[model samples]
Structure formats: C-alpha cells, structure tokens
Target chain A: MWLLKLAWKNMWRNRNRTAITIAAVFFSVILSILTNSLQDGIFDNLIKNVVSFYNGYIQVHKQGYWDEQILDNTFEGTSALEDSILALENVNALAPRLESFALASSDTLTKGCLVIGISPEKENSITELKNKLKEGEYLNEQDFGALIAEGLAKRLKLYLHDTLVIIGQGYHGAMAVGKYPIKGILKFGSPDLNDQMLYLSLPAAQELYGAPKMLTSYVVGLENPSNLDPTAEILRDKLGNEYEAMTWEEMMPEVVQHIRTDKGSLVIIQGVLYMLIGFGIIGTLLMMMVERKYEMGMLVAIGMKKRKLMQLMLIESVFTVLSGCILGMLASIPIVFYLNRYPIKFKGELAEVYEEFGFEAIFPTSTNPEIFLTQGLFVICMALLLSLYPIVKIARLDPVAAMKK
Target chain B: MNTVIDAHQVSKTFNPTTIPILAVNNVHLHLERGEFTALVGPSGSGKTTLLNLLGGLDKPDKGSIFINGVDITKLSPNALIDFRLNNIGFVFQSFNLIPVLTARENVELIMQLQHKDRREINERVETLFREIGLEDKLDTRPAQLSGGQQQRVAVARALASKPQFVLADEPTANLDSKSATNLLDIMAKLNQEENITFIFSTHDVRVIERARRVITLVDGQIHSDTAKVSTEVPHTAQKRTP
Candidate 1:
C-alpha cells in the first residue's frame, strides 16, 4: 500500500512530463477508435444498402434455379413452406419472386430487360419498394400494369400510362406475350438495375408466362441481418435436398470479394496507425526513465529492492495509461454517436461516382461499444509493452554509478 | 569489543577491463556500537568508496565486509539487497530524500520496507521527527523543506528501521554552516541518548570535530586513526564506552 502511494506520488513529480505522456496516449486512442469505427460503419452501410435494395439478407430457391434461371425451374409457391420459414427465429417476412428476361418494346424502341414479378405488399415490406417511386402510383395485387425503371423508361421513350409490350419464352416452350400500361416510374441507386429493370404484379406475370402458382425464389427478410448466415443454414437444413437457401454473401461473391479486398487495404492503414501509437508511447516512457535515473538509484541505495522499484514504475505507468485510455474512450462516444446519426454526405462528382458504382456516397461512424473497448485495449497493451523499458533498466541499473549524477 | 561493522583488506577498482583506477585499497576498519566516527580525506582519497563498500552499495574486488556478524561480500546480489534493508542505513551527500514523499513518509518508508507493525512505524516516525527537531515539518515534502531539514529527515529515515549502523557520505556537503552545525548537534544528541552508531565520510572540519573518533585516508589508504576524550561531553554521553 505504501509502495502504491509512493508510485502514485512519483508519477506526478514532473507534472508537465506526465501530462504530455497522458495526452499522447489519449489522442492515439481517440484516433485509433475513430478509424476503426469509421471503417466498420462504411462497410456495414454498404452491405445494408445492397441487401435492402434488392437481394434481402437470405434467399430460398429451387435446387437448380440459381444455376439455370429459366421458367422451367420454377417451383410451386406453398403456404406450408412460407410458414415453416417464418416460424424460425429472426425470419421477419418472405417475398416470393418470379424472375425472367424479356424484350420490352414501346412504339419506336426495344431493349432486353430483366423482369421481376412480386407480391406487391409483401415485396414492399421486405425491400421498401414503394419508397423508390418517383412518379404515378404503386402496383396492387390485381393491377394489370407494370412499374418501369426511370432509366429504362428513358431508354424505351415511354412514360406513365404508356402501353408497354413484353415477349419471352414461357415454361415448356410456351410463347409468353403481354401488353400493359406503365403504372409508376421508379429510380434505383444501382445504375445497372436502373438501366434495364421492370416490375409487374404476381398475377399478371404468372398469366403472361403461362406458369400459374409458381415462384423462382423466396427472398427472406430478417429482423437482424447479422444472424443471416446461421439462419440461412437452418433454413437450408429444414428445406432438405429439394431446395437451397443462400445468404447474400453466397449469392453475391463479387460484392464479398470487393469488401474483402478493401478490408485488406484497411488492415495496412490500421497497422500503420498502431505503429505510430507504439512509437509515441515508447518515446514518452524512454524520457521518463532517463529523467528518473537519479531518483531510482537513490531508492535502490536506500534499501528498496530492484524488483520493488520496477513494480512501482509499472504501477505508475498503468495508472497514467489506463486513465488516458478511459478518458479517450469517453470523449469519443459522443463523436462516434453523432457521426452515426448524421453521416457525412458526399457531393458533386463523388456522389455521381458512388451512384455509378451502385453505392451511396455517405460515410458514417459505428457506435458499437466493442470497437471502443477493443481499440482502447490495444493501445493500453502497446503502452504496457513499452513500459517494459523501465523494468529492464532497473534490473540492470548500477546504483553507485547512477547516483553520481 | 561490541563491533557492529568489520572490514579487512578491502579494495575496489573501477573499470577493471579498461583504464583501472583503484578507488579504495587495503582499507581495514572496525566500528563499535554507539561510536560517532568520521572518515576524513582529500578529494579522490576513497572516503566515499570505502563508505559505499561498508554500506553494501558496491562490492570490493578483494576482502570481505561483515556487518552484524554476516559476511556481506559472500552474499548474492538479491541477498545483499535484503541484508542491506534489514541491517544497514544510508544518508547520501545530497540529502537524497525521496522528493515525492512528505518528510514523515520519507522517514516512514524504511520502516514500511522492513514490514514493521503500523503502530510501531507511526510511533518510530514520530519519535525520529521529534528527535531531529523537525516535528512541525513532518507533513512538508522534501522540496518545501530547507536543506538542513531535508538532511534531518534523511537521518530520521536512516534510524527508522533500527539498523546496526548508519553510513553517511558527506551528509553536510550541501548545507550552510548553521544548517550543518544544527544537523551535527541533532546527530550528536541521538548518539548520546539512543546509542545509535553513525559513521560519516567527510572533508568538513565541523563533522570531524563532533566525531568521537576520526580516521584519515590518503591515496586510497588509511593514514591515521585517532580517538578524542572530550571533557565537555553531556552526562548522557557517559552511558556508552568510546
């Protein structure tokens, strides 16, 4: 107890030096936490944007449908399958979709387009589809019209209430043909989806394709997206060999690869940041050891064991480093929370570039408590590792020589 | 003889592998309990080196030091430190009180290191402070105290653990004449009342004058050893055989 008191008092003997060391640790912690939080935030936001935009968190489809996305591979939509899935934990809602390709024509123009038939209200609950509407009204269950993408509308030179025609091969070599008025025009953040996409009511699409009561896939919405992988595994097991359930990560290998590549670069940057923090702490501790040489010698000469002296120094350093880390974490809480609430929105060319890549141009910070705890712990460990300098110095110190100065 | 410290044929050489300098050579000395002694010497005459050897702060290249009947030279480094803590005390030329601790804490530190009972430590510290005549300065840190007061605290610290003897290396070198005299008076009073042995290495005549016996060194060898019989000594001083 006396040694502890002495160590505490000794740390403040040079108040300016101690304060400077603490400040260095404090700022390093804040910078590290901010960097980690921002990195996690940006990646999470990208995944959320992609998932909610179209794919949902998990999907269930006929075993051979994803490999060959033709009308012949469509499965019958069963209420039992949907109920069994919804009964599982974290499964919020499921929207059954029939997807295929067709030639969309309007008077003078024609283009190859991807067509998706969806239950209007169920799809809206999962993807918030109605929020993307830029003109006219949303589709209903009995509607005979289609919703056309804004870019596709421009490509075909068509607007609301225009008669659009689609022609494609239906199940088992049946001729598929449909003519319908455009009920709404929707804008999508993804340039690829915006350029060649159209949505029709489930009944209208089934009638045109000559495949009634059929679905290509069941898009499974989740109450908690983080549980996507485990839930998908459970769904896959429940559905047996006839069907396959895949998480978004499995369905979109390109997106997962992009994230992994970006994370690799982020790791290098974070390593550099940690290196800087290590050097800062080492430098401060080196200065402290130099300045206290005489005092340490005097203590040893006065019958204090070298081990005891080292312990005193360690305790003193821990006090300083721990306080700095805790304060840095507390100070960062508001900044991280504020950034998470009001993300930084990009402007002008940057915004256009993000849209061209099918992403939002905003940057946000994550408010996860784990980020603060882990980053703070890392910095503290670095500081403690640097503190070994004093212990080694004390171990090798010659009290008679050190006392000379 | 009630000898507390015994040294024979002691020698210390600095930079043995390089330019060798013999700091203390062939020094022989014995200190009895309650004796106030001085090692007087010119610059580079090995007074401080010999004092260091006696205090177990440094090892002698040859010979051995025995304090309280234990051969300190034969002890390991860790054992030497523990031995020093339990058996010896030290006061440096610079009045090296730990600057961060209060005068009371500075004095209490040795007793704490000795693992003394809390009540005993407090009582000992209070008594030492009072004996040093700095009772009111107990709460002041070393920086806030005068040089003389700081040295008194150092002396109090030295006596707190009730060691066999105290080794002081030029304890008055940095103090003014008045402070030096005041410090000497307190040390002399302690020797008379408590029979606490004190051995100092000094170039100061004032310290030499108060010492009951004086040993002079030159060229790292003891030149003269003399004992004084004072007629003006206090009655309490008669309790010890000098």
Candidate 2:
C-alpha cells in the first residue's frame, strides 16, 4: 500500500512531464477507437445494404444449380421442404426464384437481360420489391404481366400496359417465347441491376420457359442476418445432399473478398498507428528513467531492493496508462455518439460512385462498446510491453556505479 | 569487543580490461560494535569503494566480507539484497531522501520494508523525529527542509530499522559549514547514546575531527589507523545552527 502511495507521489514529482505523457496516451487511444468505430460502422452499413436488401443473408439451391444457373437446373420445390425450413429459428421468409437470361425486345430496341420469376408476396417481403415501383402497380400471383426495371424500360422505349416480347431457350433446349404487358417499372440503386433485371410471376415464367413448378433458388431472409454462418450450417444440415445452403459470403465471394481486402489494409494502418503510439510512450519512459537514475540508485543503496523499486515504477506506469485509457474512452463517447447520429454525407461524383456500388456515401461512427473496450485494452497492453524496458534496466542496475551519476 | 563488520583482504578492480585500475587492494579491516569510525582519504584513494564493500553495495573481486560472522560474499544477489534490507543502512552525501516523500514518510520507509507493525513504525518514527528536533517538520517534503534538517531526517531513516551498522559516504560533503556542524552533533549524540555502529567515508576535516576513530586510505590501501584520546564533551557541545 505504501508502495502505491510512493508511486503516486513520485508520478507527480514532475507535473509537466506526467501530463505530457498522459496526453500522448490519451490522444492515441482516442484516435485508435474512433478509427475502428468508423470503419466498423461503414462495413456494417455496407453489409446491410448490399447483402440483406437483395441477395438475402443465405440461400438454398440445387447442388449443381449455382455452377450452372440455367433453366434445366431448376428444381421442383416441395411444400414440405419449405415448411421444414420455415420452422427453423431466425428464418423469416423465403422467396423462390426461377432465373435465366433472354432477349427483351420492343419497337425501338432489343437487349440481353436477366429474367427472374418470383412469388409476389414472398419476394415483396424479402426484397421489399413493392416499394421500388416507379410506375404502375406491383405484380400479383394471378397476373401474367411482367415488372421491368426503369433502365431496361427506357432502353426498350416501353411504358405501362405495353407488350414486350421475351425470347429464350427453355429447359432441355425447348424454345421459349412470350409477349407480356408491363405491369410495373422498378428502380434500383445499382445501375447494373437496374439495366439488366426483369421480373415475372413464377407460374407465368414457368409456363413461358416450358417448365412447370420449378425454382432455381430459394433466397432466405432472417430475423438477424449477422448470425448468418450458424443459420447456414443448420440449413445445410437440414437440407441434405440434394441442396446446397450457402451464406452471402459463399454465394457472393466478390463482396466478401473486397471487404477482406479493405480490412487487411485497415489493419496495416492500425499497425502503423500503434507503432507511432508505442514509440511516443517509449520516448517518454526513456526520459523518465533517465531523470530518475540517481534517485533509483539512492533507494537501492539504502537497502530498498531493486525489485521493490521496479515494482514501484511498474505501479506508477499502470496508474498512468489506466487513467489515460479511461479518460480517452470517456472523452471519445460523445464524439462517437454524435457522429453516429449525424453522419458525414458525400455528394456529387463521390455519391455517384457509391451508388454505382450500391452504397450511400455517408460516413458513420459505430457506438459499439466492444470497439472502445478493444482499443483501450490494446493501448494498455502496449504500455505493459513498453514497461519491460525499465524493468530490465532496473534488474541489471549496479547501484554503486549508479550513485556516481 | 564484538566485531560487527570484518573485511578480509578485500580487493576491487575497475575497468579491468582497458585500465585495470585497482580501486581497493588487499585491505583488511574490522569494526567493533558502538564505534563511530571515519574512513578518510584524498579523492580516488578508494575510501568510497571501501565503504561500498563494507555496506554490501558492491562485491569485492577477491576476499570475503563478514557481517555478524556471516560471510556476505557467498550470498546470492537476492539473499544479499534481503540481508542488506535487514542488517545495513546508508546515508548518502547529498541527503538523498525521496523527494516526493515527507520527512516522516522517509523515516518510515525502512521500517515498512522490514514489515514492522504499523503502530510500532509510527511510534518509532515519531520518537526519532522528536529526537532529531524535526517534530515540527514531520509532514514537510525534502525540498521544503533545510540542508541540516534533511540530513537529520536521513540519519533518523538509517537508524529506523535498528540495523547492525550504518554506512555514510561523504555525508557532510554537500552541507554548509553550519549544517555540517549541526549534523555531526546529531550523529555523534546518536552514536554515543544508542551505541549504534557508524562507518563513514569523508574528506571533510570537521567529520574527521568528530569521529572517535579515523582510518586513512592512500592509493587503495589503508595508510594509517588511529583512535582518538577520550575527551569529555557535553551533549550540547556543538552550537545549534538554524
């Protein structure tokens, strides 16, 4: 206890030095926490927008359908299988899609586009397709009219109630042709998706493709998409060998790869930041140890053991680091919360670039407690590591020689 | 007389490879209990080195040092540290009190290291402070104390754990003449009243005059040893310096 008292008093012996050291630790801690919080916030937002909005967190398809997504690979889904999947925990809704490519033609233009057939109610619940309508009404199960994205409609020069022709190869090389009135025009955040997507009711698509009661994939929504892996595993186990249950990471490895690459770069940045902080702390400790050399020698020569002196020094450092970390955390809370509430929004070409990639150009800060705790622990661990220099120095100190200085 | 410290032909060398300088060479010395001894020599004559060896602050390259009949050279580093904590005390030339600690706390530190009972430590610190005429400055830090008061506090601290002996290296070297006279008076009184053994290294004539026995060192060997004739002097013989 007296050791602690001595350490506390010793720390204040040079008030300016102590304050400068503490300020270095404080600012570094805040920078680390805020940087991590903002990165996590942006990643979370990206995942929510790109994966959950359209791709679903997980999906189920025929074992070979993902590799060859043609009309022939479509499966006849049984109601019993769907009911079993719905019974699983966190499974919110499933939209079965029969997807293929076709040539879409009107009076002025002809373009290659992806044709998707979906159940109106299930698709609406999963992708919120109804909210994306730019014109006309949403498709019903009984309605045979198709819903096309606004970009595709503009290219084809078609309006609501106009007849558009879709021609393609059906299952087993069968010829597929259809003329359907446009029931609705939808807009998409991604220009790629907007220019190439057309949706029809499942039965109408099955009829046009000369295949009845077939589905290419089941896009599964969840109550909590963050628990994607475990849910995917459970689904895989339940679905057996005929079907493959894959999470968004597996189904769309491109986005996962992009995020992983970004994270790797961020980790390098964080490493550099920590190195700078470590060097700052080391510089301060070096100054302190150098200044206290004579005092330490005197203490050791007076029958106070070197180990005791080392303990006092360590206690003093921990007091400094713990105080700095706690204060830095406290100081960062309001800034993080405020940034979270009012994110920095981007405009002009930057906003267009973000929209091209299906993201909004706003930078938000995360309010997750784990971010602060992890950053605080990292700084403290750094302090502990840097403290080894002094401990080793004291351990090998020659008191008789030290007193001469 | 019981010998409290025995150094058998102790030798220490510095910069052995390049300079090969012998700081203390083949010196033999013994100190009895209750003796106030001074090691006197010119600069670089090995007085401080000899004091360091006797206090177990440095190990001699040759020969063994014995305190209370136990050979200290054979003790491990950790054991030597424990031994020093229990048996040895030191007073540095600069009155090296921990600048952060108060006068009372400085005196209490050695007793705390000994794990003495709290009430006992407090009582002893109080008595020692009162004895040193520092009762009024118990809570004053070293920076706030005068040179004489700080030296008195250092003395109180050295005696706090009741060690077998105290080694002071040039204790009065940094003090003004008045503080030096007052410090010598306090240490002399403590030595006579408590029968505490004290060994100090000094070039100061004042400290040498006050010591009961003086051993002069020249070029790393003891040149002369003399015991002063007994003279009756009052406890307050040296006038106080404020």
Best by TM-score: 1
Give fnat for candidates 1, 2 and onward, in order: 0.71, 0.68
* Model 1 Cα shift for residue B172 (angstroms): 0.8
Instruction: Place model 1 in a CAPRI quality band.
Output: medium
Model 2 agreement with the true structure over B193-215: per-residue lDDT tens digits: 98889998987778878888877
lDDT of 2: 0.87
List per-prediction Cα lDDT, in the order shown. 0.87, 0.87
**Clashes (N, CA, C under 3 Å) per candidate:** 0, 0
Kindly report the root-mean-square deviation of model 1 from the true structure over all alpha carbons: 4.1
Q: List, residue by residue over A97-134, the lDDT tens digit for candidate 2.
A: 88899999998689999999999999989988998899
Candidate 1: tens digits of C-alpha lDDT, residues B123-206: 898888889998899899899999998999999998887888899999999999999999999999989998989999987878
Q: Cα miss at A296, model 2 (Å)?
A: 1.5
Q: How accurate locally is residue A290 in candidate 1, as Cα lDDT from 0 to 100?
A: 86
